[model samples]
Target: MTVIGFLKKTVAVPVALAMTLGMAQADTIRIALAETPSDEMAAFFVALERAKANGLDYEWTAFSDEELAIQAVLSGQMDIGFGTPYAAMQKSKAPLRIIFQLSKLKFFPVTSKKYETLADLDGEPILLHSRGGGTDSIANVIEEKVGMKFGERSYVPGSSNRVVALVAGQAEATILDLSNTNKIMEQHPDMFNVLEMFEVEASDEALFANLDWIQANEEDVQIFVDALYTTWRDMNADPTIISKETNPDGPIGQLPPEILGSLDDFYTAAVKGGLYDPEGGGMKAAQADMEWYSEAGQLEGDPASLNIDDFWYMAPLEAAKAK
Candidate 1:
């Protein structure tokens, strides 16, 4: 071969290999998650572990709160996020869509032994997770039901932090979800009591993505969603599956030894407390959440008018159901 032709062929081969490598690199997806270990994120974590085994490259970003996670997904910093802040979704400039409904958070009004019911919280101080999170929204509903307003409420960013505040008598009452509530009740059964607040079902944690990103990576998106629903089915069928699959080196595995060891029991109690769905499809609870939030003026639009089809893409869930 002529020298010029040989050089041309070598350059073309290297360019082609570079393009292939770039395409492979572009296929990677990043998922963001809130810090809490509720059932809402169980399926995603399971799918992530499975995806690693299947040669799917991905990474995760965990935020201290749901709002931050939602903001990260909205800002395009993450391709997918676990929590769908519905109020933020309605107001964001960039279009976002819910691809999967993970689970509903059944928040309970927990208080010191001095309070027996929501009515007793007429002038009591409350510690909330944050100003406008799931816990705060639930508190709004309780105030309406009991015809009392929360006094001297404070925002403690982490649920564990809020629990600490309650334990140390920094706050007399607070609304907490099942996971933290379980931990608190177990550790100090005599110190606190959970005031049943008629079950506020307004907020659901969902899997969401930017619309443009989903369109750009449809196949990978489909695969990720498929893995998610399959994992959901497996988790709902047997909640212990995730606890069993918890990698000693993975994020869940790296939790404090005490938290890691009690995860199975925690899972069992959460499910029993109606924090998780054994069937994995909690559309009814999701619908109820929409209504409750709308009633609380947290969401501007009509819940009934909001199209369920627009909110969630059921294709992956349907595929998992068929399997």
Candidate 2:
């Protein structure tokens, strides 16, 4: 071949390569979280760090609540989100897919010393996270199991808020997760008592993404999922990693000095309380959630017939498990 022709071909090849690289660099994956920083998002933050190390570019947005997070994923405003709203699945018009289950928020009924059990709260007002959130669902199950009913109640919107309500004598009882429950009990040792710890099999947080986005960015999606599963494994393997990585000026760090200092203890207590899995894999938890939510009337179809395989893609998780 002529030298001139060869040079031209070499230059053309480099230009094409540059264009490809530019396109890949320009692509950004957006993830939505329900809050700025919380135990529910620990794995995700760790995963984001890992993903950056793996050459993946992502942006994160925090919504006020799970409903909004799900809406963001469904509307294509975000590529992925944390939280599982079974009701949204049965009710939303958008096509949202549950890519992975994060973890379960084990709830306990916390009450002042005056009350002891579910039945004790009959005709008494209680505080809940919201009208139709995880806490409300647990309340419903508790009522069913105890064959009683909750009386007049108010929505406090957050675990910390509910804890304050209970301590201030604003409400008789409230259901809360291990983290917040631990914080309250530790901060004021004598103010509250756990009435009972109720094990509700459900996914507190799940990786959700737009179906169309996944189909279009299959490779990126797979990589993101793989990093997330690996992060979960690593976080669970060493719970201290969360406290270490926590930014002193970041969300969790911005808590009052007292709360910030006790973060590590809170995480330790959470691990022991079964708030997280040592292995961090979610297949078993997902299956259990499928059954539990179905039984709780949150899911529209029977758990056995729900085609569990359709809800989650196990390839990434399986790969992480193998590692």
Query: Which residue segments of model 2 deviate by more than 4 Å?
Result: 1-26, 247-257, 278-281
* TM-scores vs. true structure, each candidate: 0.82, 0.81
Clashing pairs in 1: 202-289
Residues 1-323 of candidate 1: C-alpha lDDT, one tens digit per residue: 11111110111122112222212136667666666443334445667777666556675545566676677777776677766566776777877777666666677788899999888888778887765666777777777767888888687766677889899988878877678887799999999999876854444567788777887887777676667666766766677877788666655665677776667776666666665543344466457767877766577787888766555555555555576
Candidate 2 structure lDDT: 0.66
- Candidate of highest TM-score: 1
**Clash statistics: count for each candidate:** 1, 0
Local accuracy of candidate 2 as per-residue lDDT tens digits, 1-323? 11111110111122112222212122677666665465545445666666656767665555566666666676665677777766676677665667776667588888888887778988777787655566777777777778788898677656877787877777868888788877788787787878865566577667877566677887777777777776665666676777677655434555577765666676667666666654443567767877777666677787878766556656556655686
